[model samples]
Target chain A: MSTASPVLDELLDALRCLPGVGARSAQRMAYHLLERDRQGGGRLATALQAAMQRIGNCVECRSFSESERCALCAGSTRERSQLCVVETPADLAAIEHATGYRGLYFVLLGRLSPLDGLGPEELGLPLLQRRLAQGEVRELILATNPTVEGEATAHYLAELAQTAGVRVSRLAHGVPLGGELEYIDRGTLAHAFGSRLPLN
Target chain B: MSTASPVLDELLDALRCLPGVGARSAQRMAYHLLERDRQGGGRLATALQAAMQRIGNCVECRSFSESERCALCAGSTRERSQLCVVETPADLAAIEHATGYRGLYFVLLGRLSPLDGLGPEELGLPLLQRRLAQGEVRELILATNPTVEGEATAHYLAELAQTAGVRVSRLAHGVPLGGELEYIDRGTLAHAFGSRLPLN
Candidate 1:
């Protein structure tokens, strides 16, 4: 026998669509929405609907945007000669927030995962190729994550960029800033050692 | 420079109202909603609005319901002689799900927190007193959590029930089912030892 009302049960099930939100968390969220912040929940619903309706993939970079092109891609001052390719718009946002990279971006939206049937076409690689072929791009930076699929996607993109007569670069892999050596994984340590930069 | 659209940012901020949902999780949820399940997000929004509009406290139990009284309180088969007092509707639902407790319930919505200014009045103790005075309730079961505040609230309610000439009982506390003895806290272990029942 279900312990919650039908609407509450449907709300709980709907809340589980959020990443990392399991049954317990969904229940807590449902109860909170129902018992305390019904107004806030209503606002959230409106916001969700508005956002889903307004936001779409940027035509130029494929990142989420309210218009045909994202603000970053439409900016005239950003360097057109440098393009940073990331697996998701979230990664692009992280780099924009934390780094001084004043270049254009191309969000693949996902890595090439053969097991999941996600390939170049699925990631909109043809669009990326078209952008590179414009000859304005001098460098293509692979900013996909450090996972196996990310690495494979970056390698494939590098080959594509090289064939298009553009220089290719990968984000450096290293022990993170303020990371302890003892806690650093062996794979990262090895990559850091292998890719050690020279002091100029 | 904000990488997300204004609507997306609003949605992310709105999502943070959920308990334990931080900025990162909010971003992830927003992305998931936009990238994967726009329809599901819309459904959630509709459910949130509908639930907020329809669901309110049951007049008798104070638990969330669509009508004046909840289904449980409206049921004729339930034992009117036994009243179960719980801290929240979630707790009431838990008891209903885990056991064959057919008694009526009163939801406190919160425990007494003097520091937070949540006292007896905030938990609607007068309403509880009136219910106890109805003369139909013979036993009042305290199903509040085993926390300090929960215990204090339970004690306070027990005194009130005593004044009304109603018998009060507390739920048993022990090492949880499948919990290891070594991992159990000292307070729980002591309580378990003191309340040890005969194996007859």
Candidate 2:
């Protein structure tokens, strides 16, 4: 639909840049902001501008940060001997929220995807390698997702950790704690069965 | 999740002001923009700021416009004898897209809802009244939705049109074209049956 206002049209078009928003959703958002939440709209614009212009990767962990090092990297509470590698900052946040791990993190920002032109250099593996070569890290935990690309990235990182004389580990793959065996997918069930451990 | 960057956190919070977005969606949108589409994010910020700061309601139709009069109201191609009243600019766009109605329009921007504090004055009914009293509009078309509040607003508009000595009409209500009667809802089927017309 052709909006009577060119600015409204432009706003709608721009809103489609969001991840899941389409033309209809963009229209609703535009109308909603214009009708009820102009102040919120202005705030969003300011926030977006500030974030896009200022936010950059942390030099140490490669996670999003406004400064040279992220808070986790700059703080003294986290252990320097244990470093966890993850695909994105969101994954890093998930680990921090769900686990009691008090270690440093190295954010890959993306998994290994050759078709998309992301490689070791793009994932900042050289920086991670230099950190490992410094001999501060005694353990390297591979916490990338279980997808094909994630597995490949994890495999590559495992080799890197071994070459640097650091112990490497990966997240376990099995049925979830509350999952019923009957409902579990075949691949997971098979893997869990094959890798079943003896009772303690 | 607590983002490492304050600006990123602010951006995520401000994104929740949109109609259907929540925490997870906001996080995903922020990550996507930061990871793959910073340029698009910057463009959206610019567009949103311009729209929020500059756009205002057209004095004639009360639709969103940059200037005092909207293009539809200022143009001379449409017929002044017929005026179509709608509940929102989106509804007006739908009518313009679906039909060949080359007539003027009056956007209510909202319907009559006393509970929500929307009334005739809030809907700019006084401006509509003055336009009707000008003796230019011969036919008034009520194009509000079929909801309860929409029907109430349409009834109120019909009365105003009659007081101004203009012929009032409403869009026909019936089973939708190409809809199967067996699958239609009882309310619509019953209303269509009761308001059945002679074969044309």
Candidate 3:
């Protein structure tokens, strides 16, 4: 028989919806919320409610936004001729943090997964094609993950962009910065070797 | 220059208030809430709000409760003569889950830490003494953690229970069940050895 209070059990189960949280972590989170930081928990609740209600997919890029278009899509100063496609908003955020990629972005939200019934349509490929057919964008950068499904999605998108007369490029595959040769994965090392650039 | 939207940032920051949640985990949680399960996120928010607002300390045992007294404290079926003292409601719940110990519980909520300004008063030792002075409890179980502060607090509480003419007992310290001796900590190994039991 479960000994947990009904409300506590409900809260614990609800917390499991978060990524990477397990039963123990959920329990700890529930306790912390109830015992120590009720005010903070209340603030979290308010924030979650407000964010969920207000945030929606940006019309143009499919990234999360409170308005119809995200700030990146709405900004006039971004390079309209270049478009960067990413699998998720988190990936878009990472690129935006690291590089001066002033180009507009298209967030696929997820890659094609036939087993899971996710398809080109699910990834908004038709919309991407329409954007490419507009003939304003000169270059398309594929910044999706380097996994097998990400590769398939990238290839599919590349075909679509090339058909629409837009040049397509993929992010470089290499040993990560500050990584040792022995520690790097074999696939990454092989890719880095294959994509080796000439000396300046 | 953060590219995160305002509401997204707020949600991320709010998630950090959870125990063991760092900036990256909070960001991941925020993204999960915003991207995948807005409905579940809404549920979590509602649960947090409701639990925080409704749950308070049980007047008798100091365990979390939605009403004036916790179910354990309110239940007449429990052994009122045996009071088990625990550091937190989580610890109390753990004990309840593992054992058929039908005794009432007193949750300290925290251990005594002089360096952190936590003391007997902070742990409601006076209230505990008053409860002990009522003279109905035959045994006072010291189930505070096995840390240094936990031991000190146990000693302090043991003295209080002895002064009130109640017997004091502590949770056994030993190598945990299913634990390998090689992997056990020295303190635990030493305690296990020191408290070795004779075979019947």
Regions of candidate 1 where Cα sits further than 4 Å from its true position? B198-200
What lDDT would candidate 2 get against the real structure?
0.93
* Model 2 per-residue lDDT tens digits across residues A25-115: 9999998998899999999999999999999989999899989898899999899999999999889988988999999999998998999
lDDT accuracy of residue B52 in candidate 3 = 89
lDDT of 3 by residue, B149-192 (tens): 99999999999998999999999999999999999999999989
Q: Rate the local accuracy (lDDT) of all candidates.
A: 0.89, 0.93, 0.90
Measured with C-alpha atoms, the lDDT of residue B157 in candidate 2 is 97
Residue A113 deviation, candidate 1, in Å? 2.8
- Report the lDDT tens digits of candidate 3 across residue range A17-62: 9999988889888888787888999999999999999999999999
Write down the TM-score for model 3: 0.95
Provide the lDDT at B78 for model 3.
93
Tens digit per residue, CA lDDT, model 2, B84-170: 999998888889889999999999999999999998999999999999999999999999999999999999999999999999999
Model 1 TM-score, all chains together? 0.92
Worst 10 residues of 3 chain B by lDDT: B1-10
Q: In model 3, state the lDDT of residue A73.
A: 84
Interface RMSD value for candidate 2, one decimal?
0.9
